[model samples]
Target: MQTLETMRSLGLLTPEQYLEITAYVMVNSTPEQILAMPPHLWQAVMQADALLFPGGPAEPVH
Candidate 1:
């Protein structure tokens, strides 16, 4: 399943609100930054085990 689809399946994201939020975050942040965020912001990154990919697994950001 796609990341977006999985998010929906897990009830983290919904069809109605996905586009707006996706647009906002996509425009304002890099996948690297989002990948580094704590779960309180978006648990899906951690839950999806993507913390270690295309960005530091858990490296401190300077």
Candidate 2:
């Protein structure tokens, strides 16, 4: 989950988004594979994270 930590630090994902995405990865992939995923692939996941979660992305914070 270090990549997730990095993603959070980078502001690509909020804490809630990180938790949701972490669960998705845990269910869909082996830990070893997740650790091996390239940075670019992680970026793709970040891009899609909000959409992948149930109920989708939040309505704007405004």
Candidate 3:
């Protein structure tokens, strides 16, 4: 399995995608679970994210 860093470096994913996916992933999965997820799954999550939360995930109240 490719690490996210490796994928990013290989130009398989952009910085924005990384941030969006990583943010959603951090909120949804465990660290161990993320390792098992493929890039396609990340994209799927990103797509559904917009539909599931039209306004985007709520901003953290600082």
In TM-score terms, candidate 2 sits at 0.44
- The whole-model lDDT of each prediction reads 0.54, 0.68, 0.63
lDDT of 2 by residue, 4-55 (tens): 7676667777777777667767766987877665675566565756544547
The sequence of per-residue lDDT tens digits that candidate 3 reaches over residues 1-62 is 23454555555657776666676677768877776667776665556556545798899998
Runs in model 2 deviating more than 4 A are 30-62
> How do all models score by TM-score?
0.33, 0.44, 0.44
- What 10-residue stretch in candidate 3 is worst by lDDT? 1-10
Task: Tell me how many residue pairs clash in candidate 2.
Answer: 0
Candidate 2, residue 9: Cα displacement in angstroms equals: 2.3
Can you list the residue pairs that collide in candidate 1? Answer: none
Going through the candidates in the order shown, the clash numbers are 0, 0, 0
Cα distance off (Å), candidate 1, residue 16: 1.7
Which candidate do you rate higher for lDDT, 1 or 2? Answer: 2
